[model samples]
Target: MTHPMALPVVRTLNTDRHRVALQVFMVVVVAHWAEHLAQAVQIYVLGMPTSEARGVLGLPFPWLVHSEWMHYGYALVMMVGLILLRPGFVGKARTWWTAALLIQVWHHFEHLLLLLQALVGTNIASRPVPTSLLQLALPRVELHLFYNAIVFIPMVVAMIKHGKPSDEELAAAPCRCAPAKV
Candidate 1:
């Protein structure tokens, strides 16, 4: 009943291209998490000054860590990945993936707040640094960690469910994320 070209791009992405696209998206997400973890380790374990503990990528291009544009861009990318790749999932996997996407909506909003402050040259409550709504209560580093953990956990759960899908899920799947049964 669907038009042939109605959602051709989405259909292709969800079918043949889904596996590669999801893998690439995951790599970026994991790499960003690694950067944050590296920064935390540098400060806590290596006893480096907080300001000097630039993460792996930040060591070479420090602006990557400091720029609100960069951070917001990443949030935007995460949301896009979650949205675009969603149709490939089915059953429990779809539910879990949507959970991640919903959490990311708030996460994206936080980054948008920071980016807007940077663009407007005014921070929330006249603070010295750009701040998010939750940043008012939690330290920035802890907040970022918290956000990553919540998002990553659900995503991992979705991936695992997708991989070991029920027969119904397997039947309904649009992509070959799971192995075929003999």
Candidate 2:
């Protein structure tokens, strides 16, 4: 059974508002990607100090860079967006979108671990600041960049497939995302 609140939201998002919902979701994902890219460029290309390498928004809100809650919030939002819009996808688009969603589930778990570590004032295995499981092998910045890329790549592919769906797919799809059928 669906939660009372989830019923209408899932219906509207998957139906009448699907196209706009997808556009909004894509903007959020791309913005997050851009922020990560900006941070990487600041550190690797511009030789900015690591502490000072807050991305565009973080420049204005430096504490955001250090706040595990902020990171966790973004991860949660990404996961929710993926889940909410998932039903709008069908066939090949659904497969690729599911791939992105599954990867994001792991990414969200990592962020949750970091947030828990921060809240408890203990690193996961007791070293320094909060560290994710993957951070064991890769640095935090690189890990996040890697996570974002994998999720974004599959999501983009899904969007491309969604936009050029087959004739049957177009007929069954809820929103007008693809070109008009001749």
Residue pairs with backbone overlap in model 1: none
On residues 71-132, what C-alpha lDDT tens digit does candidate 2 reach at each position? 99999999999999988888889899999999999999999999999999989778689999
| Model 1 per-residue lDDT tens digits across residues 1-182 | 97432598878888898888889999999999999999999989999987888899989998888999999999999998999889888999989999999999999999999999999999999999899999999999889989998999999999999999998899989888799987
- Please report how far candidate 1 places residue 72 from its true position, in Å: 0.4
Which segments of model 2 are wrong by more than 4 Å? 2-6
Candidate 2, poorest ten consecutive residues by summed lDDT: 2-11
Worst 10 residues of 1 by lDDT: 2-11
Which segments of candidate 1 are over 4 A away from where they belong?
1-5
Residue 25, candidate 1: Cα error in Å is 0.9
> What is the model-wide C-alpha lDDT for candidate 2?
0.91
